[model samples]
Target: PSRTEGNTRLYTDEDLQRLEFILNLARDLGVNISGIAIILQMRERMEEMQRQIHDFVQYIQEEVLSRATAATDASRGAIVPVRRPMVTPASQNTRKK
Candidate 1:
C-alpha cells in the first residue's frame, strides 16, 4: 500500500524487517546468499560421496567374506586326511603284496 500525499512509496513493517535481516547478513556477518547456496550444494555433494564410499566399502567386505568362505570349504574338501586308523604296521603291509 502507498500513501497519495507523497511521490515516494513506503514499505510495510514486515518488508523493513526482512530487508534489515538481509542487510545484516551481508554487512555484519560478511556472508552473501550466493556463497551460502554454494556451500549448501557442496555439502550435499560431499554427503553423497560419503554414502557412495560407504557402499563400496561394504560391497568389498562382502565379496572378501564370500571368497574366504568358499576357499575354506574347498580346502576342507581337498584335504587328504584329518585322522588315521589304529592298525598295526605289519598287518597293513601284508595286504600290499
Candidate 2:
C-alpha cells in the first residue's frame, strides 16, 4: 500500500487479491502469517516453472516446423526416376510353363 499527498492508502487489483488470499488463509484455514508467506512463495515458484516449461515447448515446436519447411522446400525440385527391368518373350514363356 502506498500513500498519496493526502496520506490516503491505495490498493491495486493484485494487492487486493493478495490481501484477500491472506485473509482467507488466516481466517478460514487458520494458517499463521509465516505459513501463508511460505505458501505464497511456493505458489509463485510453481507458476514460474509452468511458464518456463510452456516457453520451452513453444520453442521446440517452432524449431521443428521451421526445419520441416526447409526440408520440404529443399526437396521440392528433386526428381527420382525408377526403371523397371525389361522382360523378354522367352522369360514370359518359361513363367507360363
**CA error at residue 91 for candidate 2, angstroms:** 11
| Best model per lDDT | 2
Off by over 4 Å in 1: 1-29, 80-97
Per-residue lDDT of model 1, residues 1-97, tens digit only: 4755766778899768766766776788888899656655786799999999999999999999999999898898575756777886688668889
Candidate 2, pairs of clashing residues:
none
What are the Cα lDDT values of the candidates? 0.81, 0.95
Candidate 1 similarity to native, TM-score: 0.52
TM per candidate comes to 0.52, 0.77
Q: Which segments of model 2 are wrong by more than 4 Å?
A: 84-97
**Model 2 lDDT, residue 78, Cα:** 94
